[model samples]
Target: MEDSVFSLIRTKYNTLSPTQKNVADYILSNSEKVILLSIGELAQFCDTSETTVIRFLRKLKYDSYQVFRVKIAQELSGETTDSIYEEIGTDDDIADIKRKVIQLTISSINDLNNLLDEKQLAFFTEAIVSGGKAIFIGVGSSGIIAADAYHKFLRLGIDASFSSDSHIMSIACAHARKQDLVVAFSHSGESRDILESVELAKEGGAKIAAITSYPNSSLSKSSDIVLLSSSRETKYRSDAMISRIIQLVIIDTLYVSTVLKLGSEGIKRLHKSRLAVAKKKT
Candidate 1:
């Protein structure tokens, strides 16, 4: 599903131009007043022209400013979740930072647990159990996640590859078959290279699953199923921070589910793999 107008504005604010951001900032900070503010009035408040204000509305996927204001007003009618990380200030002492971090992690994880749809999850799990190769694709921090998935799923006796490099991902997709599974991870779901590879693998007849924060993004659109990850980390630290823990948790869930589906045979595979790794430790 597409995000709400308020969410779209918050998520895309950084991509907006300076003038457009001016309008965004005002609307975000003054949502209640926007319900009564005219186009000219909002423009004056943003210190931008009326035309720019209209463009900002259009950017939010609203055809007009009035519609945009109405959406915000409607959202105001319901309660919204507060950002769990709001209390974690940069200037806090070490102990305070640690406490806030733990508190936020517990709250965000609980929220994510409640938000996940069982039907959507089952679709992806069944795909993995259907006897095909699985390819994991991600970049940067998400690459670490994809790599971790590679280790976990491979232990279940599935044919899996973790491709972090863009070129390698494209190559993997090039060789992907109809039964192959391509799972892409990108928090923004807007990573150009990842999107390109996913699109290619999709065309090549691979079933795709997207794990991301945004459900309506391009990557999600390409996937056969989506596993949404919800996080509330600080803006700059989102990709590399506690969100990664949530993602890992998602992978762990998938791992255990697949193991259960594979049943007794899956345990044997895991034991064998564990023994091989144990030999290395010796």
Candidate 2:
């Protein structure tokens, strides 16, 4: 529920009329600032009447502007600390950047705690443990995250693999069955190739789980479980810098949670894994 507002916006945005689109665009582009403003102020900024803003909220399934803003505040409050957008100025120093990074890391951790549904996460891990195979899909930086998650699960003895190559990923997913799990990653949840692969896996009956910044993203909608992350954005682009870090944090939590759930046998497996790697290093 902490992120339901975002999911709602994404789900309803395309369905809005031209007038609502104006309000939706303004709200999405300036969510942080919107949360801080009065409804009348927001209506004025969007060049719409007060009634339109209220109507937009209702269309998104929120009761009123007050309710919508409350959810937005919660969403923004969970963003990585370093994500506070600050303009580059002539007087800026290294300390400013350092402080921002520290705050961002702390914010990411807190956001992970707030945004992640522990029960849902645990169910996802359980699915992995019981799964016959696990396939991870992503592109770019998210591809790397997917690969890392694949390796983590592999080391823990879950059958897992990842592919950055879209063709290969699609082919691999085509072979997955109902007992398999496909964990896809995409910050925007709008990645074409990733979505295609997810569609293939679903048709094949594979259970799905998605890690994305937007809970309402297409990837999230298609998956059985969704994990949300927070990030800072600039006017033109939303960088994955902080969001990826938050995603990795969630992965770490999942790995550790799995270890705990697996108990003594899990510890034994981990020890054996460490020794095996150490021997290979020699």
**Highest TM-score model number:** 2
Q: What is the C-alpha lDDT of each candidate?
A: 0.78, 0.78
Q: Cα lDDT of model 2 overall?
A: 0.78
Q: Residue-wise lDDT of candidate 2 within 19-86, one digit each (tens)?
A: 88788768766878898899899989989888988788888767777877887787678773322434
Q: List the residue pairs that clash in candidate 2.
A: 82-104
- TM-score for each model: 0.70, 0.73
Those runs of model 1 whose alpha carbons end farther than 4 Å from true positions after fitting are 1-85, 233-236
Model 2 stretches with alpha carbons more than 4 Å out = 1-91, 235-237, 280-282
lDDT of each residue in 72-178, candidate 1, tens digit only: 77777764432222445567888977776776566556656444678878988899988889999999989999999989999888899988999999999888889
The deviation in Å at residue 151 for candidate 1 is: 0.5
lDDT of 2 at 214: 75
